[model samples]
Target: MLGPKIREIREQLGLSQKQLAGEDMTRSYISLIEKGRAVPSQRMLKIIAKRLNTPMEYFLGESTATDTDIGEAVLDKAKLYYKERNDRACIRMAHNVLTLTKDVLDQTEAYLLIMRSYNRLGEYRQALDNGEAAAFIVTRTGDRERIVQYYLEMGRAAFHSELFHAARKFYEQAYTYSSRLKYLQDEHIRALIYLGTTHLRLGNVDQGLEFYLKAEKEARMAGQPELYGEITLGLGKAYYMSEQDGHMQLSYDWTKKSVDSYKLARSESYVLALHNLAVIQLHMGQKKEALPLLGECAGIYDERNLPHKKASILEEISKIYLEERELQQAETVIKEALQLLELRDEGVLRAKLYRLLGLVFHEKDNSDEGYYFLRMSHDLLKRIHAEREADISHQILQLSKQKQKMEYDDYKSYIR
Candidate 1:
């Protein structure tokens, strides 16, 4: 069935058996394949299809392949790569599937896989683009679950990129979509979690805490410890950041529970919980207490091959050392963090790293390097988050003992 179609397209393209076979594949094998006397392996079929300028799915006799056919085979392999955190391979395979499948469902799945692979690779803009494509396909499908999932994934990508308003919009849509379904406990809880996170980022801390608490209740009722753990962590963060001092202990307790609950089940959540615990400690000026928490978070990020998380944890550790006036230790962690932030070109974190490095060098009596870094941080602050420029500018001026007037473009000549 497939051989005739392959031969038809091959001939239409004016390609002979030997031309299609290439050096590694014999012409006899190609002849056998075209004669329907032998079958091509999936790999060989892919090569043949590419050479013939047709979707392999076409020759496979499915007008469009489902998410379980040859397209699914690629998806499955991509998923395996994702599980192993081999983002490059996952991304490559996801794109391959995108080109090979015509089924709407299969295409949506491929776009989603590509989105997540880009997310893992820290390509948030590309992640959003692919997520939007997936979302567009499902817009008329009425699969509320998939709609919620699409929004949730996009919201997460935006959140990771520090696009808080965009994240909120996507998460709000996720909640709206999930709410249309009557009894999907998991979807409801997940949507609530993302919505609450967006709320927190938007500075609606009280509202975010309420959603998190509600979600936590539902999670417990549904017997989902992972969801419950995440909710508990959210609650901890809300409380820890609130103006009320009495909530600190509650935050600490809840954060610890989240860490313990997720420690064995969810590696990502476990590391996040640890980071939260460290934040709580740091907020209370207990830098020493935060060290072990940040240390564990760092180790987990490394084990998981998460450069962003690792850089963040390392930055937090450096902050603790800075608090303790441990200049050498602070410098060490800040340098390590810069390497990681630079790898992904994390502008937001890079700005903070520059400021920290600047402070460390200032304390080390290296005025020239200190001034340079602080000025860079100030410039970044002005460009990225202008609201924070006032405080950062003050730091820059204080660091400049000679008070040399460094414009925003001062560091451009040397650094860029």
Candidate 2:
């Protein structure tokens, strides 16, 4: 059988099924083929033949493709997988291509693709490992453009891995290299954005702002809404995180600009920007303005079926109502938030909501219901061993007396 022959050859070459399958196929599929339980397709058979260095005729009495043709075909398939965002498949196909070619440029391209695939999969260390190999081979080709791309990909991996220092270095190299290439304006600007974010992560606020401002100029010139939104968002964060004079106001202004830009770009980050703007308004004591923004965010979260986020907004709204001494409004919002919590395992939030409900009852002079809800909050926090459980317990003890105090004392001395 073809399966027997394929297995025989594979074993002779001392290649595992994984190595034989490469990037275009799966190890399990190879196992099935070797076991004679599944037949390999003509295209797949050709790949197997090329990998095993045997002509296709040996398996199917046909020889329509050469080794070089198979190598190019595999590489093309790798590119297709990459385009489709099937990163694992792309990595396998790229690995296969490496086996069929000795050309430094082709090997470097394979390594670069592998690095990018690993990055997409959130395997940053593997991405960096492939990146090192790509960088080493790319230097021999003397291709400055590929070098720029390599650094950019490496920077992205490092950035996501929280290796800010390494990310900054790679992004700087990419920016410097892309600056020398007239056609790489987009890459140059992207490098500037990366540098800004990396510097911000490293707590270099002024340096981050400088990079962001430079990228902002390029983004405005390009008239790209999404790019402008990204830069403005970074600017907002830079201002928000700063302790400089009027920083809060500047943060609000930049954040408002970012929200507008993101809305124009139809970006999904619009809701998040709205939330940030609302928080900034609250910090500025513009509670009136913050309420409407919070309502808008709550509505969006509800429509998006993000129960936790909607409940969080409701909790904030309830807190504001409590602050205004609108007991009825606060109770209504708290009950709504509690209803949202019914299906969730969010013990912390549930406990907080119960505690708020207790406060509302206490404020209304309903001591019986107030202590009941407070005890409910305390029990939940204790069950979860939450960090604030002891504080809640102390508060409960202070608010209750006699029988209630004795019951809590027993719980504290025994259960605790």
Q: How many Å off is the CA of 320 in candidate 2? A: 8.9
lDDT of each: 0.73, 0.76
TM-score of each: 0.65, 0.56
lDDT string for model 1 (343-381, tens) is: 666666787788778767766777788878888887875
User: Which lDDT value does model 2 have at 232?
Assistant: 85
Which pairs of residues collide in candidate 1? Answer: none
Model 2 agreement with the true structure over 273-341: per-residue lDDT tens digits:
888788678767789899899989988987877786788788778877776678899999999988887
Query: In candidate 2, how many clashes are counted?
Result: 2
Query: How far does residue 219 in candidate 2 sit from its true spot (Å)?
Result: 2.2
Q: In candidate 2, which residue ranges exceed 4 Å CA deviation?
A: 1-69, 291-416
